[model samples]
Target: MPFVIAVLLAADAVSLMAAGDRAFAARDFRAALFAYQDLTREDPGSASVWVRLGETYARMGHDLEAGESFSRALRLNGKNASAKEGLAASRERLAILSPPPKPVVDEAGARERYTAAVRMINERNYRDALNALDEALRKRPGYAVALVARGSARMGLLDYDAAAADYSAARGSDPSLASPLFGLAEAYRALGQPAKAAQLYRAYAESPATDVQPALKEYALRNAQSLGSQ
Candidate 1:
């Protein structure tokens, strides 16, 4: 029975490793991270698994986690060249004082598209608004305001999943931007994720008055209260 259990565990590790590799090759960092994390839990002593986790974290720009994972792999197997390389790379990234500069973009054209999207949204033409926002994002990737507007357009079109994704991207691009919180909360609510919705609503409500309008804050608080009851 012990031998059989060992074989099953080995099979599970093999399956997870394959899944992680496939996800990593496809640039699906989130899925790769999940599989690698599960591998860490199941086989903590596997230096290979730790190295793979480190690679996934590095690809996702999580330098701190990558550094830690690489260190763990090196500790488990001091001769692991991959772990050493990853550790060195992560350390270099960590040592950088400021982030690299962004690529030059046509800001004027992007702003024009964003303005068109806002106008379309005001007219309730969500489809057109989405198209304009897409053009704006294509011109200027990581445009936080355009992302928020796109999220709103997606919400209007009942595409809650896409809306949530856009809102999440906007939040990542500009953590201090307050609009994504309310938009993301509404998207979560529409997607039936009441807990996440409530959490975001509470966050929106608690934002400084200078950041969030009084009426929006009041509305967010009311929604938070309503969702918390569920």
Candidate 2:
């Protein structure tokens, strides 16, 4: 009777582990979360189970829970790369959600703000241009042109990292767009990453022709400098 009982428990454990793995493989994150949660409750010593739970929480956007799960997994297995990566990503998402407060504006105000940003950029007022762009983004998220303009303004201010992020955001909004790629190449050049700058410049050069010749020329000059510096 005791042997039968032990066999039944072992079978149940195997079933639970298989269910968790199946849910994770299907990318059914919520289901994976539930399955892993149950498995962890039954087998708290399983480091792989904790890591899988963390990944599911991360995929579901439960950053705090994900961080905790990853921390637990790391405690169980210090060399777990997926757990470490999930923890880092969750922390980053939490940081973004709780970024320092800035002045807010409405939708119409965002258009006005972007117009002001453009005017300021034209006048070489880099600081004010960025501030205006920030205001615009607060009201209308994912404004690609505003992001590109902000990147250009940041380049003028020599803030290469922020410029790169803005240009990247712009490109993400429109992958085939050349302007953001040019901006990214210029930013990479400023940051002294010549190889990456050259690659981006090549991408921009091969992009479809638009009224972007002037920007392309600017990128070409930076790419030349990057190559010469190498």
Candidate 3:
């Protein structure tokens, strides 16, 4: 009877997961949320389920709930990649939602904020660095240096999507900045989008303006080879 009960529970979980996937594919995040939430109730220890729930919450713009879900997933499996990504993204969104300090309004003030963020990054305090970068950007929306710095901080936290956005924005705001190419490639790699990463890495490797280091080029080339389209 115990064996039969175990089999029944496993089958139910599988059914729930299948339903959740279908809902997610259809872009009905609320349905996905319901299915994943039920799955967690039935199998509270499933780390992947918590990660899925976190992702769904993030998609629905509930940053607080998303963070909580990611936290649960991390508690279950400290090394869960999806949970780590979700947690970092959630943290950024929560910070963005908060009220910003009075605008610094001066280039020198923005530079000061950016320098403070750099110090935070050096200390490995990524979250505080993000806050500082956010303030810097608010003071100077087109500050390419601050954008790149913020992207670096996000990358350290494994928040690949946000990092990619920051890099892309920096590149757009200042076309002369070749540094964003390398940072953008790294973000794509972390997000498991190897094709985009490889393409950008190859561009950086081939560009004379950006190819300041041969070792970095070799490293990028090897990564592209390892993560081929096949």
Question: Evaluated with lDDT, which candidate comes out highest?
Answer: 1
How much is 195 displaced in model 1, in angstroms? 1.5
Per-model TM values vs. the true structure:
0.55, 0.49, 0.50
For candidate 1, list the clashing residue pairs, or say none: none
Candidate 1 lDDT (Cα, 0 to 1): 0.94
List model 2 lDDT by residue over 1-230, tens digit each.
59998798667878888887898899877787888898888779878888888888888889899999999989999998988988899999999999687645477888899999999999999999999999898888877888999999999899999999999999898675778988888899889888888887877776674736876666576775667567
User: Model 3: per-residue lDDT, tens digit, 1-230?
Assistant: 59999999999999999999999999999999999999998789999999999999999999999999999999999999999999999999889889987654678878999999999999999999999999898888789989999999999998989999999999899877667888898999899888988888877777676424688778777876776653
Question: Which ranges in model 2 have alpha carbons more than 4 Å from their true place?
Answer: 1-108, 209-211, 214-229
For candidate 1, the per-residue lDDT at 34 reads 99
Q: What ranking of all candidate models by TM-score puts the best one first?
A: 1, 3, 2
Q: 1 or 3, which is superior by TM-score?
A: 1
**lDDT string, candidate 1, 1-230, tens digits:** 59999999989999999999999999999999999999998899999999999999999999999999999999999999999999999999888946888777879989999999999999999999999999999889999999999999999999999999999999999899888999999999999999999999999989763568788999999999999999
Residue 48's lDDT within candidate 1 is: 93
